[model samples]
Target chain A: MTINKTWLAGFVGIAALGLAAPALGQDKPDNLTIISHRVHQTVSTGEQGGDITKDWQDANGVGVEWVTLDTGALHERLFRELQLPETNIDIAFLLNTRAVDSVTKLLEPFDEHMAANPVENIDDIFPGLRAAMTFDGTLYGIPFRHASSCFHYNQRILDERGVAPPKTIEEMIEAARQLTFTRDDGTKVYGFLINGEGYANTVDLARAWDGDFITLDYHVATTDEGMMKAVTLLHDFYEEGILPSNWAAIKDEEVNNWMQTGRAAMSLNSCGRNRIFNDPEKSQEAGNIKTVAIPVSEAFKDKFDVAPAKVEFWTMVIPANAKHKDLAWDLVKTMVSPENTLKAALNGNGPVRASTYDSAEMKNQLPYADEEKAVLLVGRVPLPPFDNAAKASDIFVEELQAAVLGMKSPEDAMASVQKRVTPLLPQ
Target chain B: MGRRFIYLLMAAPVQVLLLAVIGMPAIYVLWLSLHKTAFGQVPEFVGLANYGFVLSDPYFWRAFVNTFVVVNIVVYVELGLAVLMATLFASGMPFRRLLISIVIAPYAVSEVIAVVIWKYMLEPDVGPVSAILASLGLPELAWTTDRWAAMTMVALLSIWLHLPFSFLILYSARIGLPKDLYESAATDGASAFDRFRYITVPLLMPAILVALMFRYVFAFRLFAEVWLLTGGGPARQTEVLATYLYRHAFRYQEFGVASAIGWLMVLATLLIASGYLRAMYKRMLTGDA
Candidate 1:
């Protein structure tokens, strides 16, 4: 049915009126608008909307406003708000992967703030996570939480197969080959499930395979031998049916679902996912799952003397154009303070503060605390900071998908990625 | 003159609304196209550099080609199918009301929801259709991975969701034709085919053109169906102009390039649409069948 003109007119009028009015908490002194995910709700003293801000205000004697968006839109929202400072969002909790490039253009350097008002136990933050929040030797953001890709496997499935947790890429592949089969009930169970849908997962595997697809200087090494091997290995898995036919379409949530429902014996998932697997309510494999360090690519095995896992972080930053930068830093300080970091850890966010891991409450709450802490020490950023990181990743993933689907050879795919990516990098 | 003034007064709100919604944005897009802007950076006036860059990019050109091809296919197929169904309905089929509702149901489903449903149904491993094919000892084709398969799937889904709108327009037009004309044709020794071709074809041309023009513009701006399905993937084979523009604007943060792409799309759409109108106008003037 067509929309009635009367109804349309009324709706538009109401919308215009609402837009004309100032938002509910815009005018108050010390009232800061923060953009972040609702995961911050986990750190709030009270339940529901603005509770974290209220709690922060009560504790620190300041007024604050909190707004949230999905993870996909957070970077775009933060970038837009920073560009248009009139939006009045003073602070943002953003992914560090995006923040690294955004810091110089959109965020204020916190070196001066750190010098003036040093956060207690700031040194206790994991070096990898702290490094992720820093750009060009100047700290741009404070670590809020960090997640690293790790090996999560169903122990019962492994035990039934009489296989050990894989420590190397070759061993993992062999185990996957052996464990993949259909059961008597005609249920198809796969051996390995990886979130191989995007660049992050591809980069994780590339790093493990010793493919220096990205250099320390933010140059694309897409055609590197190790990168080719990495792509080829994943393609081989797809070709051999060791992975599901729909592996190219699998995402993080599906990996979780596969692990939770025991459809897969092993999967490369995240520390945050381990929290879900350990929860009896959310997972059928609860108490039967185990977390191990991610297996390195056989080609790159020599480089991983310490056996590093892929690490990424979520951080809080003050925008350079923020009207109340100092207050924003104060809020950031409070949010990343040792006490609050511990609170975030307890909320199922991967702890960034080393001290938080030492807490008895953390030990009690996190079943994989030991594995996570160990991995954090060796966790590495798979892709370094660059201005065109997002675009570059998109190009890489497209080529990676082509290779995985046998649309292009590994060499050809990497060449395509390299050709596209070179133009995006700095001259 | 007084009545004209009253008409102007009546039209003022709509005129202003159109100006604000369409005219201003159209002008701003042209202005934005001349600048070099990325998210979080100050826009720099670059004087046609964005247009130069977009035009020179191979992927942009590919997207442009894909947009034209996919849109033309969807429009013609949908129009053909819609005209056939409308004619059948006008022929007095049984359960006409029920059939009409069933046809219109797809239109009621939101594009995003419909695309999601189609994506799941076509998914290779877990989808019921794929399972049934597998059970029949058929190969499980990777719908999103194969370029032609991906494009065809997106086009089919687009037609499925949008056919109802076109069908409804044509159906209404078909039913509105004078019944006495057909009676006269029958009396003149016209067969059913002859009656349709001689009477229905000429009369229904207006509705067909309208539906074609509407679907042309609509399909030309396709993004969600293809993007959600394959993300212009399997090596960007299914990428369309709109999705390409979105990549530049949002994902790549190149607002200037995106604006340039937007203006290009508008121009291309106008040229195609006007060509249709030009033919229709010539047909009208020439009294061509």
Candidate 2:
């Protein structure tokens, strides 16, 4: 009886071990998953092909997964996941400002990786993009996409009003006033709609004003007269009732929709605005839209030959705790290659590679390639890197919204932002 | 003996599920509240600093006040409307089932869908409601811009989302009330209003308290509706404590401060709930038990 019981116990123990094996195996991390803010549609479609993720996996020979979320959702998820030490995010793409503020500590600096496998002909990449991707003299990310601010106008509207797209700030304002009209129902249509609410747009507006958030040293708020002038210009539009009362709530898609629907004659948008105007399915007035350099201030014109056009870039980075950092970097390499960059640009992303922009295929696919090339030449990089960018932007956007909503004067709003943001700056 | 064993066997899974799902998480959250940690960072012992920070911050206090105001308005409005409707239904009014079903329809709609619908209607331009108001020759009121109006809008939306649940609870309580008391009150020449006030209200107090507690707690952490609508905008005027916690923890990535704020909120909630329970206990003991 004792011998029989011992054999039965051994059999039961072996069965238990067999069941536990799969659980142990499941707990081990295998595939690396990259989370980014770029939508799948932005990365793949039509001639670009919709299987970029599959292509990435095939090329890299790694078990990989890709997920795309919007910018805000991506930030929230990254922050939340990073709080848990066991999170499985192998790589992440963050807005430059967010990288600086939140994920800087979570990132593994890329200096070692860049040294190990330097891209051949690295100098061919845009200098501004390279600078934007560098933080504290170490590369934390690689620039994946970029856009510079430009004025997008409805050629049809301008022709109807017998006005040209303004070449200077004064002329732009004048044309805006002239284009304003009142319908029989008494609802007024704006000639221009400035994104007066958020810091994303205000950065471009600040460029026009020649204002720097961080001084030339990139360490403090400049608070120059030009920044104040930009703020004042926006305030004046709101005061004159030329701006929408819903301006505070307007998002990028809404702005694009408004411009495309002929609700506004001209608006300041990024270089990507060209893509929107050319999209046949999305734009109602597709063929009629044209791009030009944003009008310059007289003060800015003396210092800068062109309008204070700004260059901005989005980058991808691998997290410090990434289980598959090597694989993640490989994917980044593949996605950012000149060939893939051209594919991404064709699919609607602003390409970071100069060679891609200069390629015959890109020029053929993108109708306004020449106009874009002209605008790119004059574009200046925004003063500070994009990391922790949203914090400064949050303050600026709040102040702008406050001024636009008539809660505070432009001067007070600017002062408040300066006071709030100055303390957060690095000592 | 076999039947008893089978009964215990049947209940084992349910008991284990309760312990795993509810008891474990509740204990874990309590433990987390006691520690200081950043995202992807290990927790360090911080006895009560998080709680202290939350208590001292003016923003926390402001959010706390806003939460109370919103919760009070929503609860009182919903309770009043729900109890009246319940009483009407209990009175066997015409089309009572139809009225109840129609009233519960909004509650059946998910919070996200309800907020989305309301957002479109409240949009300053291109919204039919706004258009109608304009046609009435009224000044286009920035309903979402002003502080009081924004808070009211949130409360109104909360009330709409919660009306069906509140009504169902109170309606069932009304229907289940012992009929002998109503008959006795009528024999004593008690008017309909007097009977409802002296007897029906007293008898339904327990149910009302339960409904009030549910609405109050839910409103305190009201996130999605506020986030989707105003984004706590106009200078964070509409921001509640929960939204403030979320902004700090996620948006700003200030996990230390956020954790501290979170623990303090938990403490405040516990204290308020305890106080409520104590009062209810006192009332229960003092009343005709």
Candidate 3:
């Protein structure tokens, strides 16, 4: 099993020969490498990959390359590629979760780009969306997609159970309990389908229960009564068979599948998922899936009209080491153009531009446009975009899972989360 | 002395390359472990602070325990299965070509693909395996929610993906064993089990030790199985050393702490390898049957 000197020499020689020829990239005129997730590309350009560049090449004689990766890989790739000594990646799409303070340092701020050659209707983008792409009063990216959270339920189940749509946190729990039962086909449908594993599902629940896990100013609110109530209720629901038995382990993709296949009755999902949940081809509960603003907690009804839901967005940025900055800026301008904004919104993107919702066609086509607009007005960014925000989010979820799974008391779990996460957050 | 110097000279290129590729990075990481480092931030000399923090963290101990238990399950169980298969094949089993191909098929699959395939196959509600198990009225695998079940599932997967490696090695050793010893043992009226225990097993000792040594090292880095499947979850219950290192390095951006954990893993690996290495050396030196 050991390599002798002669054999090792031969292997090394061959490997050296192979490594001698590194790939030398050819830079062509007006050619740029753009990296993003597939849905982001599709929404911005109205095509998944090809022909968007083709049209641009035909019109402006400039070609673009799209490198699509999933969310985690996209963030990692962009982060690594931007810091490289030489990179061909002109523009990259960053998710809101990753658009933190340290990352903006590696990106080209658009303050100068906007001042010189601003995209049309620059002021039309929603405030929340604008906030996601900004750091220290400077814009580093243009918002492309902003999905606000919404409470989605199966209307058929509600009708069958003779329960009204929940308008408060307690009522929502009661309705979820009523919704949990066996259908005619003997399929056991859980009342709720929230992912107890992560910040996305439970953060909104914290707000609906009238508290926050962490605020924009780095405040840890885990010991707040509202936060305690949120965790306790989630635990109670799981124990009572309201939430799925595997709620602590359920993924975002699985939550979508549960709603589509009628395995679960309700979820705190993004407003954009309403389209997928009601797609006749993909969902059995099509047309029966209903959307509503997350209900405010009864105790805090006087403080707020409706529950505050967090918005996660995607924005386009130019890498600091980018070769073709002007072309990248042009592409970003084209993507954020008023016409393309409306087009992307129609193609299932959550519109970042407010004026897109003002169009009659947008209003007519997007049935929940007004509902989404209301959520958009009040939507809060999930975190403060701190250096270790992702790490903090991860710590919160670990404690939350422990709480939900009955391994720790809710108070103890939240206290643990607060203790562990506070050290990672900015003071 | 002249001939020895020539051999060293001939091996100089590869030795230097190994130093550059392996030794240098290890040294750099050791240096980083003493400082406080993160991406886009300057490393501040905080000598051993990261080590202290990581050592004190309960999750680190949890990861260590998970790695130990899961790896023991994978390596030992896989070694047992591999020996059984190698013996069966050596006994002139029927349809050897077809059976070997089927047995070794997992070796061709990439780790990511294997994880994806198993993730879907074991999904609780709709996966074919789950459906079949439910129809048979068997107890359901709550891999997603239950910590014990999740760890077991990861270990099971590691065994399946890696069994082919141990099996192939053992099979080669078994097939290469001299026929004369077994024949002579049979002529001396030794039973088949007696012959196997005395002749076959004694000869296969080297191969078995080698397989254990390699499998132990391979199984220790049980990252993808836990990460992709459970994400160290149902609250970091199935976390192993590799995932713990990854979470710190990538998610937390704590490069300094990650390096400390990485060095700790290297030390742990060396400790494991030393045991088998010493055994193999003893066998070689003593010429022990």
**Which candidate tops lDDT?**
3
Winner by DockQ between candidate 3 and candidate 1: 1
Model 2 regions more than 4 Å off = A1-33, A37-64, A67-92, A101-116, A194-197, A273-288, A302-312, A319-331, A374-390, B1-36, B40-47, B178-189, B282-289
Query: What would the DockQ be for model 2?
Result: 0.23
Interface RMSD (Å), every candidate: 2.4, 3.5, 2.5
The DockQ value obtained for model 3 is 0.33
- What is candidate 1's lDDT per residue for A1-427, written digit by digit as tens? 3569888998999998798656422333557788888875455443311233456688656676678888878777777777774657788887766765644657789999999988877888888777766777888888876778777788888888888878787788788988788877767778887875577666656666656667667677778766776788889888888788777667777788888888888877676677677679998999888887777766565667324667887778887877777778877887777777776666666778878888888888777787778778777776777778778888887788888888889889899888888887766
How many collisions between residues are there in candidate 2?
13
Error of 3 at A227 (Å): 2.3
After superposition, the stretches of candidate 1 with alpha carbons farther than 4 Å from their true spots are A1-30, A45-56, A84-87, A100-105, A185-187, A223-226, A260-262, A275-288, A297-306, B1-13, B135-138, B279-289
**True interface contacts reproduced by each model, as a fraction?**
0.56, 0.32, 0.56
Candidate 2 lDDT, tens digit per residue, A305-326? Answer: 5565677767777878666566
Clashing pairs in 1: A208-A297
Ranking by lDDT: 3, 1, 2
Q: Which candidate is the best by DockQ?
A: 1
Could you give candidate 3's per-residue lDDT for residues B142-171 as a string of tens digits?
Answer: 897887889988998898899999999999
**What is candidate 2's lDDT per residue for B142-205, written digit by digit as tens?**
7556877778888888899889989999999999999999999999999999999999998899
Docking verdict class for candidate 2: acceptable
* Candidate lDDT (C-alpha), each: 0.79, 0.73, 0.84
Better of 2 and 3 by TM-score: 3
